[model samples]
Target chain A: MKHTLSVLVENKPGVLARVAGLFRRRGFNIHSLAVAPTENPNLSRMTIVVDLEGKPLEQVEKQLHKLVNVLKIQDFLPHEAVERELALIKVHSTKETRAEIIQICDIFRAKIVDVSQDSLAIEVTGTEDKIDAIVSLLKPYRIIDLARTGKVAVSRGRK
Target chain B: MKLTGAEAVVKSLELLGVTDIFGIPGGATLPLTDALSRTEKIKYYLMRHEQCAAHAADAYARATGKVGVCTATSGPGATNLVTGIANAYMDSIPIVAITGQVATSVIGTDAFQEADITGITLPIVKHSYLITDANEIPYLFAEAFHIASTGRPGPVVIDLPRDVQNQVINFKFPEKVNLPGYKPTIRGHTRQIKLALEELMKSEKPVMFIGGGVVLSNAHQEVKKLAENFRIPVAWTLMGKGAFPDNHELNMGMIGMHGTRTTNTAIMNCDLLFAVGVRFDDRATGNLKRFAPHAKIVHIDIDPAEIGKNVKVDVPIVGDAAIVLRELNTMIENNNLKKTNHLAWVEQVFEWKKKWPLKTPDSTDLTPQFLISKISKAANDKDLIITTGVGQHQMWSAQFIELNGPRRFITSGGLGTMGFGLPAAIGAQVGKPNALVIDIDGDGSFQMVLQDLGTIARYNLPVKVVIINNRYLGMVRQWQELFFGKRYYAVDLEKGSPDFVKLSEAYGIKASVVSSVSELDEKIDEMINHRGPYVLDARVKEEENVFPMVPAGASLDEIIGGD
Candidate 1:
């Protein structure tokens, strides 16, 4: 099972390396990860999606909490959290495929961020599933390049 | 008053009650060394290598229960400290390692003697700091000591850039550390403690599996109280050697790989395994699936990550070992808990112990066991601190030496570093000047860091180095003999080995060599009674291997020897 953990950490150099090093050392499989500054200037929040097949999710959480920079960790169930992923898909586009690509981007509510004579860069943001669906739709037109900001998550709550 | 970062570091160390530091001066750390020399509050012992500095600091911490301090320069010097830092991390010794980093501008530019030490030590340290500004020195130093000594206790690294060290700033030591993320849980949850106690009361074949945490927390008294009050047998890990008295009837020797037959048997037979401060490591667990199969485990550890790390637990309590044990002891006393007798279980364990005693062969050639036994007897009356290099000799020392109290046996239990003993003995000797510090080492392991003999001579530290001179790397050779068809590839230490007696003499230390069993007692006495550092190379039987062996990946029932 995949576990999405929202970790709050002190904004310090090597904190991310420490966390990443731990996961590597312990052999925990990381599926996706996104880190950014939080509301507090001195703190940063990291959204890590880990595949926990061999070890328990609780153990990973406990281990993350062991790092001195890690201030807080919350494991989010799929239903209890709102997760988002952003991706930029650059497709091989010519006169024949440009209109079709724009139509597909329109259907997914994505915007054409950049357009050249032979290619189009489309930016899309949604849950991982929606992004995957759009990517599959555009795959018929050869994907020249693709980039994804793995997943960022926030718990849906007032608790 | 304004002061340079180097001065701030020295002042901060003094403020933190650090009386001694172990390190050698180098280019990157020259400024810090100058400042250290200028300060009268701290004494610096120049080590031959950065690795020895770290090991000495680790042993100092283990011996004194204080945060041991070590320093080193950038790049290779910092890299050399990795093994010792990892050793301390594994054993949970409180130590602060200060490394001089290349200037901030040169850290990533591959400048002379540049290394990202903080990055290198990220996984092993409890916390680390790379100071870019001089002002951070006071705060970082305070935080380094706080993190190293607090909660579970592990090594912490502070990487001081040369430019940052030269920057001048007003020095005012932080009054308190404000790390909101690093609060250690001291007291066990009441409900969990109650549940654990209930499990103990219900168990008929209960055993307490203790480890390094008990020693780290100074909870030996609490562990003894809990075990004796409940009539529970205590089986200790190698790191937990001195946590309980070896002579006590209830103490069932060291457990796990290279552990006693009786301890393993008791662990297998026990109904309730109350494990405190043990990680249930692979060496200790053998085949995890068959380990303590019949027991319902209640594990108490300060680090929550360790609670269910290797083995699942029925009841998990996260708290400091000493505090939790103390709380449990108090609750038992206040509630007047009935002590259940396990006479049958105790008798069964005693029978196993009597039947499968760790035996020494009837031979005139000094075996490692016989040599260690002689040393143990000679040092029995003195307050002794025993350290060992990893291998067959380490196991023999652990088996033969009877540690009566905590803080007596210090070894690289976690990392099992080969060259840990000599420098660690120096550290222990330096920490406890009056105590007899002995390094029981193998011929191969001793040769790894033999240069530290200079440190011992210069300091005039009365650390006795006893090398069990088996011609081969005995432990690996034993494995080859058993499992690898006796193809002893590259395990021999007989070729190109230095004459240790001459090496010690050159270093201005007393030295001796004993090849016969008859000379063992007299030689050990002479070494122990020596006024300064001494080295005794006792040539032991080359082919003898450590027994009561559970071959790798084998269950406890598959133990090979007990005859």
Candidate 2:
């Protein structure tokens, strides 16, 4: 089972390492993680999606709570939260293939951000499934470079 | 109020009621130690090595019920304390380790005498702090102490860089810590406590299981009362040895791995297991699959993470051991209910206890069991403390030594660190100056930190060291014989093993050698009667192995009776 854990940590040096080290030490597999500063400058929010491999999410949360730098943790069920992922892809483009690539980007609602003599860089942001679909569509092209920002999540309901 | 970070650190420790600390100073520690030297409130014990220093602080915490303090310089000194810090972490001993760090400017640059002690100890400690500002010294130190000694006790490391120590500020020590994420649950839920009580009341073959938490919380009295009221047999882990008095009828000796056959039988036969302050460590539970197959587990612990991690618990009560037990005891008393009689069940356990007893083979000459039993019997004082180095001697100490109170039996139960005995004895003696502390050690285990003999001698701790000199790492040799067809790889220590008696004498401590079985009692008495630190190296049979063994991954009932 996959678990998306929204963790609020003290904004300090080595907090990221502490969180990463804990997951590593406990043998919990991380699928994706995105970290950014919250509205409160004192706190940073980390969105970590982990593959528990039939292990209880409660165990992972309880262990995470033991870290002093970790201020709060909320495990969001898929339906309870809104999640997004961003990907930037650089694909080989030619005079003949550039028009076809632009059409595929339009169908996915992705924008062509940069154009070089031999490649076109497309920027896309959507649900993980949408990102996965676009990456698979672009795999046929000779991909030059790819970068992904792992999933960032927030609860669907109130503050 | 104006002071440097080093002075603030010393002032914070003084305010916290710390009278003694253990460590060795280096270049990075110069500023800190200089500030420490100005204070008469704390006396520092200079140890021979950083590892031994940490072990001493650990034992001091165990003996005194105070957060033990130790310090070391950067790099190798901090790295050396890792073994002892991990030992304390595993065993859940409350200790505060203050390490010197490189200047804040060169922290990540791999500067001279630089090491990230806080990061290195994150997984091992309950919490840690790397101080960046001198102004936060008092607050961080207070927080460190609070986190270390509260709900589930463990070690905490504070890494203070050299620049921070030298930075001057107006120090204002806080009375209470304000850590939003560091609150521990102290009271058990009323519903869960009631459920646990109802379950225990209905259980015909119930058993009370305990671990180091009970000892750490000093919940022995409550445990005894509850066990007697419910007519339940009490089985304990090695770390829980002193939680219940050995003389009680309900008391079952150490259970699991090296546990007595009697206790293991009772645990396996029980219908409901009331586990208090236990983590259900694999060594204590043996095979979790078959452990207490007929039992419904009621686990009450301070840390929620420990619940259902090892075994699925039926009624999980998260709270401090003493608080939970005290509430339960009151509930039983106030209800005016007639408790079910478990006389038949108790009798059944005793019958098993009698059927298979611990029998040590002494066909040839001196046996380790005989020597330990003699010392245990001779240690009649209420204040006498027993510490052990890991291996055959540790198991023998757990079995033969009779403990009637908490904090009297101290050993590296969780991490099983060797060379823990001698330094622990020193710490225990230092903490309890009027108490008699004895370290029962093996030759191989003793050789690891033998240099610390100078520390004990210099302090005149009046601690006694008894080496169960079998001339080999007996526990490993036994495992090789049983599990590996007697390969005996690296288990032999007969060649070039130090003469411990002469070595102790060389360090200005009293020393003796006892080669005959007849002189075992006399030598023990002499060591006890001696006014200063003493070492008694007693030669025993080389092939002696601890009995009533349950092989790894085997159930409790599958114990091999070597009798």
Candidate 3:
């Protein structure tokens, strides 16, 4: 099962290595990981999506709790959280298909961030599915370059 | 005095006389490593893997009596060290593993890379901790070392957070550790000792069974004095191989699965079995129902949990072996146990020793058994230490090697860990450099921690490794042949073994090979006499098995002995 874990860390050197090392040593696979600064300056939150079954995840969690640098770990379910992925897609828009690309972007609520003579770059931010849907729609226009920020997620509301 | 987690770690190294540490850097542990940067006295070893780091530390601990130290970052890194820690715990080696943790404020909130390493390691450790206060660091460090090195020593882990490491406080290493929760009883009850002596004096057929704790307690002298005073025959468990010198007139050799026929017979017939510092393991006592059927056991150990957990005892005393033995010595004189002499039993034991003397087979070629004898001769008592990996070589060492002192013969008896020899040899060598340390190991066992040769080379430790290159897991095969109708499973290792001499050469250790029995004496002499680490690969018979074997599931009487 692929599960997303949001971990708050001390934002120090070797912390990533330690986390990666633990997973590697245990033979657990991480599908995707993105670490970024949070609201707290001293703490950095990392979102890790791991493909592991029951016992190994529990074992990894237990061992992670042993590390001195890791402050907390939270497992976020897909259904409960508002997840988003930002992707920038550039399409081959030679004078002819630029208006059609703009029209499709408007339908998806995506904004045209940059325009060159031969290409149109669109920035889309939504649930991973929403971003993928827009990227698929613009695929027929001849996609030039594509980049994505892996999944970022948060729970539904404050208690 | 108060200290930060960083300085506390430094102070701990100073206390343990540790010149080096093995670990990697991480968030929670950064402050400690940063502090280490300023220290000239201690050097840090960075390992590619955290598990390897723990193994290196374990090896160091087994080689040296000092607590072997290793560190890792939070969560995964800390988790990687579990196997090595468990290995140390099983073998009862003294090690201190330090790991970084997530800060206290967000500890349970699933912080980045944070793990509950202390909780995970609690079951495997003698003691473990999570220091929230900066002032607690010094005391905890000292206590961890104390707990690790003293009594029945094992590994302890101290989890440190980034906040604890960063906190500033006046640091002074305490002269004494004052942990109220862990007070190991140093002295045994005088009354209990008196009762044990009375039991010894009254019994006509009393046998003394010793364990590894005798060596751990450094009570060989006391054990010897009591044995001589009572004139009782001594038999040992696998761990207690060297507790009593095997060459002694009263020694019946090791008593268990591969024990001598006479020892097995004596154990079954003895009226009182004085088991000291030895856990009654299953291998030692095949079927508990029939184990020591004729004898009333007197079990003495430092760990209370181990007392009733194994074989039940009529009399149990929980205290330090050395302390208990000392008290027992005094009580014996008062109770007149000294006045009683068992010349008849001594004569019987001597007769048995003569009948079942461990003699080398008449082989012109250099044999593994003969090679072990040569190693033992080179070791020559005088505080010499010997370590062995599990297999034919281990049993050969147990049978042929004479243990003149306690703790001098070190091996992983309970776990039967193959890779134990080299690392343990390192620990023993580091612990006593003046003492000649020899690892009488098998090829199968030596390969497990072959990478540790790097540690030996880096440190320039003079550890003599005698590799019995039989090219097989001799013990497993022996059992398979005897019990499983000759079905050879994964026991054979004829294919993958490196040219051992060349491998040793690659590791920068002086290497030698004795393919023939004719070359055994001279080659072993050269290897042992060399001051640096030397590996001597002695090619012995492949089919040789450790004998006088007690067929499993059979009674003690059903032993297979050489005619």
Model 2: lDDT equals: 0.90
After superposing candidate 1 on the true structure, give the runs of residues whose Cα lies further than 4 Å from its correct spot.
none
Worst 10 residues of 2 chain B by lDDT: B355-364
What's the lDDT for all of these models?
0.90, 0.90, 0.79
Q: Over 4 Å off in model 3, which ranges? A: A1-159, B1-4, B15-30, B40-66, B72-80, B102-115, B172-180, B334-341, B381-383
Worst 10 residues of 3 chain B by lDDT: B177-186
What lDDT tens digits, residue by residue, belong to model 2 across residues A72-113?
998888899999999999999899999999999999999999
Give model 1's docking category. high
Per-residue alpha-carbon lDDT of candidate 2 for residues B1-563, written as tens digits (9 for 90 to 100): 79999999999999999999999999888999999999999999999999999999999999999999999999999999999999999999999999999999999999998888888887898888889999999999999899889978999999989999999999999978888877889999989999999998888899999999999988889999898877788999988988899877778788888888888888888999999988999888899999999999999999999999999999999999999999999999999655665678988988876776666565658889888888888887647899989999999999888888889888998899999998899889889999989999989889999999999888888989999999889999999989999898988888898878778889999999998777877888888989898999988888887878899899999888733
Query: Which structure among the candidates has the greatest DockQ?
Result: 1
- Tens digits of lDDT, candidate 1, B1-563: 79999999999999999998999878889889999989888989999999999999999999999999999999999999999999999889999999998888877899999988888888888888888999988988999899999888999999898888899999998999988888889889989999999999888888899999999888999999988887788999999998999889888888877888889988888999999999998888899999999999999999988987788799999999989989899999999998655668877877887888887767877788888887888888899899999999999888999888999998888888999999999899889999999999988888899999999988898899999999888999999999999999999888899898998899999999999977777888889888988899888889998877888888876787756
Candidate 1 or 3, higher DockQ?
A: 1
Q: Which one wins by DockQ: 2 or 3? A: 2
| Model 3: per-residue Cα lDDT over A129-156, one tens digit each | 7987998899998999999888777777
Please say which candidate is ahead in DockQ: 1 or 2.
Answer: 1
TM-score of each: 0.98, 0.98, 0.73
